[model samples]
Target: MSTSPSRVFAARLSGLPVFDPAGDQVGKIRDIVVVLRPGGLPPRVLGLVVEVFGRRSIFLPMTRVTHVDSGQVITTGVVNMRRFEQRPTETLVFGQMLDRQVTVRGTGVVGSVYDVAMEPERSRDWVISRVALQEGSKRFGRKGQTHVVEWRDVEGFAAPDGVQGATHLLAALDEMRPADLANVIHDLPPKRRAEIAAALDDERLADVLEELPEEDQVEILGALDNERAADVLEEMSPDDAADLIAELPPETAEKLLQLMDPEEAEDVRRLMSYEEHTAGGMMTTEPVILPPDATVADALAHVRNVELSPSLAALVYVVRPPLEPPTGRLLGVAHIQRLLREPPSTMVGHVLDSDIEPLRATSSLEDCARHLATYNLVAAPVVDDDGRLVGAVTVDDLLDHLLPENWRDTPGRPANPVRIGGTNPGGSRG
Candidate 1:
């Protein structure tokens, strides 16, 4: 069996040089990747989030990494060079873990987790085993001391400590996957949940809000002022944002809609007209589409430019002429694999797989699922009467309807109930 990767405080590697085999300095360590684990064990390090050539950030998988020491990181000399876009399962140390407070397991509130300590494991990878913390003096103007604590030694991240629980909870919660955090929040007391919601940044809050029950959604959205609430909604996926808006008191919903970015609000409003369970309702307004006359290189470039997720990017939809933001008419579809197999000059229209019929906006979830299953496709396009490609119903979103309503809340679930926060742990630098 292979041995697991060694432990290192995230801070220790910050700004460290990444050397390629030939001894060339490739990039500096910008952050570490951590995946929050279930079972209360410390989160394991997945790899390093590195910044290259002074500007772009890309993920360096642990396997590609050869060595990590006090002041340097060594890699296998190869790098993918694709820019890093954080996955739901991953956390970037510097971007998300610093300047926060957390409860030390055996210690009292050891504020702001100033740094994280991680262990590398393969894909079933990641565990945060140590943390650096900062503590301020009671004197209003004094700076806090920083210290290190083992992940196992920190108290739970989210149980209410009455008064400071909300604050401590905020710190620890940053480390959680959005879905898991939402589950934790759903199970918490209403008031406690609201406190956490109010403290969350719009991006993080919007993610959690998407996973929650409507009532919880309403309550949390209520906790924010109209402006903030609208901001959060704007950050959310248009379909989910629209669904939540539909549940709000009409006046509240309208006010928020007005406050949203006009273009984004228009997208959500268009979705609002569809039934929640229909194809249109579950579809995301944004799908990478290209003109039928475009070449394989064009399709590939479009998907890459949009930075679609692995699942969504698997296939690029090809549409007829008016191929602007929302493509005009559905010409057909082309799998990403097909695009790659051909010469760059190959026309996307020539490679089309027109065997499947598009799903109507009113198609039922069952029909959508069947279509995806039959074709072995991850997503099916949704079209309006004019045959314009309005959106797509991804398999993940479709599964939501197929699964039991409270599937996420079941006992012993990998992610049982939501609560996310964590500060860099350590008053002492590594």
Candidate 2:
């Protein structure tokens, strides 16, 4: 007996892994590209914007898909690795269709949208079944009432004939995760991409910029004035920021550096000294650090800072006195999980594990990956000859560099292209 095929909500299908018939993972579903039809017919599924190996974006025709499971997808052994480009008629259901002010034919601005519910239609297409609404902003924790309305009752934000693109997309885009937003930006026209980049807040733009390819990074930053460029760089991880700046011409890179906060510039400047192939070259200078005398409460507070990334906040590095910024001599380290298990009043120094040997600035890229894999660590501390904590090589950055260099260009044949003196002559190791 054959079982009925599974249907997934748009919100639930965002990151499902896509695999070929042989069970080989090609990429994951980043977004569904669709074209809205006139009259009452549902939107047609043009293809899928599959993110290959989490590094490259490609388009897969609907005919290529064989199955759609909860955690993964199955494809028919055919896929076009060329980058997916959005045409004027296309609307990305999850990336573009979501978060607009939903208007009911009669209700008039009933609420904001969170997702588009789609059902299988004729000819391997999926049509909108309903508009998923959140009573309040999904960006906030309100978890307001969720209402699903049939497509016929929803009139969209504008009249069908007057609709150009998502007019409300900018507001909805603001609530998207940086990675998701980055994917959307990557598919847009260069001019539109620059416009979106300019509109993002310093912090949001910084996060999204980190997700952009090196060429795009250079393009976006070069388009911005020196001061604005410096502001975004300051908001990015120094290591990532350094990688980007290193790609700029000496004069341009130097001008932006001068515009940055001296303290932050120093961090990027220090990382510039290392070869891109080394651990020091791949590390971030913003890991959480606490004085040897600090209590668990202090370590927790440091991790809670809004500016810290999840990777940087994963572990706390311990150091000696003069610890205002805690970039002193590296003493030991404690995972955030362990800190949470210990008493809040307990001194962090007592909890640090000395057994985890730190990586040197000179350690090779291979050595860094091996260290992280060996210990199953997300990030490893980087120190100099004197054992002072200089920065940390995060797993995320390491994985990106470890991939084949051309992964971005070809079915996998093409890609920093992320951050120093504009790119350090050492290369795009991080």
lDDT for each residue of candidate 1 in 157-270, tens digit (9 for 90 to 100): 433233332444555445666765675566445666776787788998998998887888999999889999999999998888988899898999999999999999999998
Candidate 1 lDDT score relative to the true structure: 0.72
- Report the lDDT tens digits of candidate 2 across residue range 1-430: 0121534567666767777666677776777877777775666666677777545677776655667645677766555455666776677775456655666677654666777766566444556677777565456655666778887777663432332333235554445578767777777666656666676778888998887778888999988988899999999988889899999999999999999999999888888878998988888877887788899999999999877767778899898865533267899899999999999999999999889899998999889989999998898898888888888888888877887654444444322111112222221111
Q: Which stretches of model 2 miss by more than 4 angstroms?
A: 1-83, 86-167, 324-326, 406-430
TM-score to true structure, per model: 0.59, 0.65
lDDT, model 2: 0.73
- After TM-score superposition, the amount by which residue 384's alpha carbon in candidate 2 deviates from its true location, in angstroms, is 1.4
